[model samples]
Target: MNIDLEDELAAGMREHTADLKPSADLLDRAARRNRRRTAAMASGTGVFALAAVVAVAMTALGGTPAAPPVEPGAPPAPELLTVAMVQERAVAALAADDVQHIVSTVDYRGKTEHGEWWFDQVTGDSRITRLQAPGGAVTMDLWQLVRDDKLTMTQVFHDDRSYLVLERPLDGQRPPGPAGSTPDELRAALQRGEGYTLVGPEDLAGRAVLHLRFDFADGSDELWVDAETYRAVRRETVKHTPDGDARNRLEFEWQPRDDGSLKPLAVKVPDGYTQRQVPPVDGPM
Candidate 1:
């Protein structure tokens, strides 16, 4: 019975993996990378296990918990970066917006290991109050948990389901965009060209956090992260569009995620509009 269940589960995962669209896989790769960045900026260590736990909990619970337990080795409470040194750096960086410890997001349109140069949207939310596009225009709607640093997007609807979200995991690091540009992708993006800039750390909203900025010729991105858990306290973006600058700011407050993957929290939508989950694609991963 156990063997059969395992087989079924594995088969399901495989089918999901196989049916995933390239874009969703790219987003998933970016999410993993951002989480790692959050971990690094906060803890100075890569703790995939914690992320896995949070992921499972979030997926199962359908909403992020208000508070999550702190493992002994985990970064201290009131700070999410997970490291003392990183916490200090975040505090210092908070004094100024430019530098701080962090995990941030960016959109890239350049060369990569895949030999495919295309436009990719990347999001790295950490301990900050808001995120804006480079031109201060175009705010992306994402899945986030304000109580804990559980921020990610399972699905994104751009103008009534025009664009969909998908995700996947790979054996090695990936590069920017088209199904693989994530933190793992960063390893390769760095190899392809000069990667993002590491500014330093900072204090945001009375909390010490890290900050990192990535600028491309097209536009720029910023990240504010929690020093203890490496979770996003706030993220902002300024987008450069031919029309004008569009801005978006996402704020998070410390909460518990004892339930699961921080999602399905209250969504702030415009009046007379509604939020709904984009149905799973007909096929597998």
Candidate 2:
């Protein structure tokens, strides 16, 4: 076409399209290049004029520029539980709460002893005063016979003259408290992360709790902690045996240091008592 004719045609095009606003996508692209967004296309009039020329040329060619390669923002990945994160969370939760060593519950096997029991964290000394023993309603004092630094893992009571004691192998390295004696002990134990698996969140009794599992060769032990405070709530240990599966369930309660939970550190054993060896209910060595 002749130069004068082309100039005249461009002038006519500008007049017809001058009032038109730039396309939303084109304005967005221009704004990005300028390092700041311009909500109103008119704010960048010079850039808009050039964009208008490109749009008119494309329209005449009967084709359009491909939409800016829109990259969709990827959704955030969900947090995983069976990883180190859970270990840190579980450890932190227990550390924030400060309570006594432990107040224990009864065994859940051959015989049931329903009462409250606790342990001494600093001394490794524990005592359980039961309102009722294996027999019926009567006061009973449960003690573990510890001689020197070794424990025979026997359950001995001081209330009755005749007592049944199930003796297990001596473990010199074992501490004084029962297996699930204290959350403080567990807080330290869980630092390894391999000792237990955070089974995930769960509902226990009527409140929310997190279930942590520790696997054994013959069985497994599961611990539940309060969902909010992350304190110890309950523990269940299952043993697979030739006879059957022996299960022991215990619920924990924590008290302040000066709550009279432990008044006298030393427990007095009865002077005379007959001891017998037999299988035990929910026994732990």
Candidate 3:
């Protein structure tokens, strides 16, 4: 595992679990489900190989050939897709603008894990697009455009002051801020063909994936891709910050529905956390 990949994975773990605070009813159900899954993963049955490429490609079919390589550090030259192309597909997939369910968990001190997210998307010209957490404390404030998506944070029943700006738009691009937006940007960054080395293909939990190592000034990232589909499946990032060494890991499993929409059916959140629905916007505001 490379540094970048480790750091990213850790970050994903933290980000995914940062806020729990759910109701007892929701918490009980979530904890029961997560414990079962976590046990499955920790069972260590050598099932990681089943998750690499085969599982990802079996979700949806694509029309592209093999990708050169898009890991962190090695050769900077590779045949990759452009940002525009990636976004085009994502946008088309999200055109209907249905709800976005975010199933996640959080880890406190690297111990127990518990969490889940279900977001209902609201589209159209409302500059104030909101991702209502169906039973939690966080809501995503998305600045939406037809061609770009930017993220910010908002508390359910509080003032806008709690808002935190996430990623901004790219130069000259005012795209819609849908669920597919940022992933599309990340895809573009990967396709730019400039910042990684190829490590060859490998297997993940019941899937076949391509492995790439990335290098940075102070650290690095290890990326896992679905070999057949050319989409990222997991990333681990490692960085040496001023405070200390930080590691983040992120794993994503997406299944494209017949409607062309991608859905995340499960996510493993670290321990000591709860996920709940955000209050409705029409309530008391």
Candidate 4:
């Protein structure tokens, strides 16, 4: 009996459980648990994949990226304005203000002379009142009026008793150049100029302005235009001379009437003055 005890126990245990089988409910529960674990693992993997895709999409769409930190104390650069843009703005501003009053002063050969100009853009009429030196010796006050394509000049002599008046057609009486206080003339001069440079912003007569320099064949021009209105405020012309340079300056101040009409400019002939009429010529008079 001692010798067969281990073999007998093994045989009895096998025979007792020979008909055993798992219940259907238990099998179903095990399958459901397996499916749930599989579904949860798939969901977690999908979430990770979706997160990666979203990050890639944001980068592709140029989403806001981190900016490099800027230095603590740096000044920004000033904006640059072009010459053509300034000229265009100036021309537009001048055209909007159709009337202009200009005071020009010329200093040459130790002589200083003052001139006044009135220009009407709508009527194309102008008046110049100045002192002229005909032969470089005597200075006489002269008034020049341009109306209806005609020029009339009245000169008051030194004695104040004798005066001279001359009238001529203006078709070819003057050379082809900037002939008025209009900004169109300045724009044209800038277009035909050889060298153009922006001298930077400056203060002229207590007003901010842009300083522009242009060179021509015989002379050069320095123009100061208002920063806000883009209108010409002052201009200086330097003419090359054998002895020295002759500087001519023009200062413009616009006076727009409250009625939106041009101011009247009167030029009258002196009493008992000699009148002379010049015959119309083809070239400059």
Clash count, one per candidate: 84, 1, 71, 0
Q: TM-scores of the models, in the given order?
A: 0.28, 0.47, 0.36, 0.55
lDDT tens string, model 3, 58-170? Answer: 12222232333333532222233332333344335433434333333322344323223333233222132222332444334333222244433322222232332233334
> Of the candidates shown, which would achieve the greatest TM-score relative to the real structure?
4
Candidate 1 has a TM-score of: 0.28
Could you give the C-alpha RMSD of every candidate to the true structure, in order shown? 23.5, 21.0, 19.5, 31.6
Ranking by TM-score: 4, 2, 3, 1
| Better structure of 2 and 4 per TM-score | 4
User: In model 4, what are the clashing residue pairs, if there are any?
Assistant: none
Cα misplacement distance, residue 264 of candidate 2 (Å): 8.1
Write down the TM-score for model 4. Answer: 0.55
lDDT of 4 at 50: 25
Worst 10 residues of 3 by lDDT: 52-61
Error of 3 at 240 (Å): 1.3
Candidate 1 backbone overlaps, count: 84
Per-residue lDDT of candidate 1, residues 60-167 (tens digit) = 333333344444554433322222333334344332222122223433343111111111122232222123432342234443322233233333344563333334
Instruction: Sort every candidate by lDDT, greatest first.
Output: 4, 2, 3, 1
Best by lDDT: 4
Q: Worst lDDT window (10 residues) for model 1?
A: 111-120
lDDT of 4 by residue, 185-283 (tens): 776765664545665556566566777888777888898888767888988998988867788888887776434435445555557756545457797
